[model samples]
Target: MPQSTPSVVTIGELLWDMLPDGKKPGGAPANFVYHAACNGVAATAVTAVGNDDLGRELVSLLSDNGVNVSAEVNDYPTGITSVSLDANGVPEYDVVRGVAWDHIAFTDEVRGLVEQADAICYGSIAAREPQGTRDAIYAMIDAARADAVRFFDINIRSGFVDKEVISRFLDGATILKINDEELPVVARLFGIDMPDESISGQQEVMRELRDRFGLDVIILTAGAAYSIVMGHDETSILPTPKVEVADTVGAGDSFSGAFLAYLLRGYDLATAHRRAVEVSAFVCTCSGAWPAYSDALKEEQA
Candidate 1:
């Protein structure tokens, strides 16, 4: 018998990444949904796009990749981020503001989707936008089932962040994902000390966040270096598997997606961490986040 797929609903921006070569569909929430689906979970994306070519293509690409879309068509033009990669395939983004996703209005449809989700993924970028978008996200969170896992990927971009906003989101998040740099920034904001010279201090930082936010799990990442996972029972720090370079656009989001999917599917933290690191490394070997997932490539890496 075919097993049921764990359902994950990701809410936030969906847009094109206008890379130097051309454009591809990309956004943190969209990347999370795509990789979650790749991890054998039933994933859906709740975001917005203009009713234009870019929007249509974005939706079609997501659907083709096996992610369900609950996107709203808005009057603003579709969102896009101009991307340029450094020599090491690390990318810098100039995100376009005031797009369709900026105006994602609250609706019964989004609420219903959240209510049905086993895990709901969101990012700081959405709430950093218009008041309406933040309100819409809060409403969806409110409608989620009591036990639904609220995964917050702390994707801070530009000046689109503040301590108050992050704190408010933490009140609802069951899981938190942040990069190495953001960890110290967050620590300082909450009066948690982060000692650079000590690994135990780092763990303390993670534990403080976990306890402070009442989070079930915490994932801290360092690009192409390592990642740390702290939980109620155990904590593990895993080095990123080596891989040939490509533009690292959605690598972090891919990690979050895979970790959540594997965890929901009953994998232990260590096992899930390995898979998450593997998947994220694979993403670094591809040009974009929503790359054409290759079974052969995955097996070869394995």
Candidate 2:
């Protein structure tokens, strides 16, 4: 896998996760792109930032990390969210609405990139917005269907997702990734059997999704438990590596990014699953969603 070949295009929100300590540059798509870059996947992020200082900082961060920022916009002020941590260290966010990301207008350049993409990663959170960005992403999906592998990383944020949006994205996706809690919600919405309220039942739900949608892959994450990877021909489970948590912010996004990176490099489901879990563990050992030392740490783990 040569580093020069562009392997992925992640289209979605690019914002700052403002922790109590300070602001951390994040957004699911950006996090995925970060890990993809570490895995030698030539990745580009198509997102928008505001014309404000925060947006400028985000662009600088991306540039410093070796991520391509040519498609990132600076028309609107950058989006910001204040994150509050609980006693257990779980994060709760207060998202500022109508920010820069809400104005992600599609352009001829974005469409052209999508048409040339090898893989595309997006999520439902970015689609629940002022409608313009959502429309742009949907358009890109339609245009990229023939030549790209669309990965729907269903990062369902509270108050930022709806059934219609979820269904629409699922229909356009070639692969789907969701955390344990979201699997049942999506399965029941799609008229798939909810089955029993167990992890195996969730696996059954995923199997139904794969069979019904003809999806190439389905990834399910269960926090610090084991994660499941299922394809048409095989299934594999990998346990999360035991590590002291700094914060669980971008662990799932890291998993999604690493999984796609390995898959694109022609790794088997089992091996990819292990690598995804390992990278996610590395992320949890750090503070923010897009950790500063991600690439070097990942190389050490490898």
Candidate 3:
């Protein structure tokens, strides 16, 4: 076997968000891969696209951003979601179904590439379709277990995720990320407490999740407030930096990508946490999910 490369592999849907102005390439996996590349982590996105114009444009966009799309399929029409922005510029999505991403067929090359990765990032939303793509994701997870750290960003979209799929992904995950609201839902699914007060209570909730799921790291984001990072023995709170918001479209995904990028680079949890905050804040300053970075913004920490 060839030597394994220090790269992150993100697997999920790749599609365009039909915004009020036009279409923008946006999906959880694609957004995460974009930030991973921006942070200087060699990253590839394993996803499927359609054989249509939207798919071609998405491929071109990924190429221009230096994200590898070699494992991307073009068998069906590209996936698309309609975005309706609220007064505060937050987007509510109406995701279209039966797109190419719903039937993602994994090739031998995709399996090989995943096996060579240092980390793999996936989410529950992508696993909630057609059953074939979900199986493909599981196959990659099983094959990459020895070499890759599986980071499960449990992006539970309504009408998509169910209890069984979330439980299965958690069983295979090394690290997990979820928002404050989703935490309670997941805890209830696992029959844990529905807390009402205090960050300590929240920490306990997270600790229970880690202990039950065998998680090495658990990240919980409380929007516009502090985020919590919990390990087996340590727990720390990192504050979200105040910044002018363009949109909150991919802030969570960017945070997950940056955190993984820093951790894989051998940074301590505190350092990684800080880096995640900074990178996420920078992303929120721009309109798109994955914002273009300047050289200064991409500077590596010593």
Which prediction has the highest TM-score against the true structure?
1
Task: Please provide TM-scores, in order, for all candidate models, with all chains considered together.
Answer: 0.95, 0.93, 0.94
Can you write out model 2's per-residue Cα lDDT over 1-302, one digit (the tens) per residue?
44556578888778899988888989889999988887767788888887677788888888788788644555667888788887645688777777777767678888777788889988887887848778977887888847578999997675665777777788889899998888877876778878786778988999888877778899999988888999988899877788888888778999998888888877778887888888888888888987765566657535
TM-score of predicted structure 1: 0.95
As for TM-score, the candidate ahead, 2 or 3, is: 3
Candidate 2 steric clashes: 4
In candidate 3, the residue pairs with backbone N, CA or C atoms under 3 Å apart (3 or more residues apart, or in different chains) clash, namely 50-76
Model 3, span 1-302: residue lDDT tens: 12333599988888898888778889999999988877667899988887777888888898799899864555677889988888766788888878788777778988888888899988987888748789888887887857568999997675675888888888888899988878888888889996664678778888888888888999999877889888776777988888888777888889888888878877678878888888888877778786777666766532
CA lDDT of 95 in candidate 3? 82
**Which model, 1 or 2, shows the larger TM-score?**
1
Q: Name the TM-score of candidate 3.
A: 0.94
Candidate 1, RMSD to the unseen true structure: 1.9
Backbone clash tally (model 1): 0
Q: For model 2, name the residue pairs that clash.
A: 50-76, 50-77, 50-78, 51-76
Index of the highest-lDDT prediction: 1
The lDDT, on a scale of 0 to 1, for candidate 2 is 0.81
Task: Give one clash count per candidate, in the order shown.
Answer: 0, 4, 1
| After superposition, candidate 1 runs with Cα above 4 Å error | 1-3, 297-302
TM-score, candidate 2, is 0.93
